[model samples]
Target: MVAKGFTVDLNKPLVFQVGHLGEDYEEWVHQPIVSKEGPRFFESDFWEFLTRTVWWAIPVIWLPVVVWFISMSVKMGHTVPDIVFHSGLRHICVTLMEYSYIVSFSYQTKSYWGNTMHYLLHGCHHKHPMDGLRLVFPPAATAVLLVPFWNLIKLLATPSTAPALFGGGLLGYVMYDCTHYYLHHGQPKKEVAKSLKKYHLNHHFRIQNMGFGITSSFWDRVFGTLPPQGKDVKAR
Candidate 1:
């Protein structure tokens, strides 16, 4: 969501009026609450925990598939093109299916934890975006879904293809996380970041249906949900 300016005081009680997902822009209510000043990265007790969680969980989810694909290639003496085409197609299909599942679940429940495993995984961030410590997903929670996701991938695609698709999908996840974090915290004077930051802020402020594309607006534009450009767009 877009703040008119970045003048939020973390040390004081602030009231945020958040629009519910799919709710009309005018329906927001002022929610007054006190929050502690979140610890800085180096000083936070959870810093090491967050780091280890991301490090361990990501590899656990995608590495076995990588090893499997490598072994399969060695065994078959497959060419790079053969691997790319076959495995890439499998990865794409599996990734799409997984994406659908996550989105569906998130929309249905409106809770990030119940829906997916990315930063803010579901819609929790929409409810509490300014909660700095909770702004990003905790690593331990990410580990919880790895086995289930892998098992689902196994059922949908061949062993060789599962890793490639999963790996590509993982790359997408990384891009999403980085872009999202930057959208919240980066001070970009360039056009691209300026546009994305404004787009995402609108998702927070005015148009929730639009700007669902975090890393890219590819899907948002295709789905006809993109918010209108410039001052004509209403802000709640």
Candidate 2:
């Protein structure tokens, strides 16, 4: 069955079938299992996955690294003002790197899997934004990328600077997760949220290439991908 504006090809063999009911009767039946599973409890799914895997060790993994950076900064005896300024600039750089990676992925490939990965990473929310259990990244998948990111920052910046920047970047991810979850599940009907919900829905229902930003539409506006106001954008 088609929901929202997406088309469902039930005519495909995978979705069409024949069934027998009894020794005396036989009939054709069509039933499809979309995806693999149904909704799960948000907290139960999150904590259960987090506690069971080595990937769950991510929060602990960075602690020592963060502590070492703070120690190095203190040992350097830099003035508070100098420390603050450098830290702020480094954070901006980290944020830029995080943003750049997602945008670059969009430009680098035309494969459907590449597009699906993007959706799995971020677009899934737009598709089923209110699916509460899927709001957060699975810890196992998220940890795979964290190490490479940390190492990249280490090579480009001083030990002291890298942690501060990484900290800010991590904070950005947290904000992204929280805001995205709220955008989908929160009940606020205020103008801003209403507008945001509509903007996000358009991305899912109409133009997938446009309106890529979630926490803020700054990137969409900057990249000239923002959807037109007040008009229904049709999907490709």
lDDT of each: 0.48, 0.50
Which tens-of-lDDT digit does each residue in 23-65 have in candidate 1? Answer: 3212211121223223122234554346222323445554565
Model 1 misplacement above 4 A: 1-123, 232-236
What TM-score, to 2 decimals, does candidate 2 have? 0.57
Off by over 4 Å in 2: 1-123, 189-194, 231-236
Which number leads on lDDT? 2
Worst 10-residue stretch by lDDT in candidate 2? Answer: 19-28
User: Distance (Å) between predicted and true CA of 12, model 1?
Assistant: 14
Error of 2 at 151 (Å): 1.0
TM-score for each candidate, following the candidate numbering: 0.56, 0.57
Q: What's the lDDT of the predicted structure labeled candidate 1?
A: 0.48
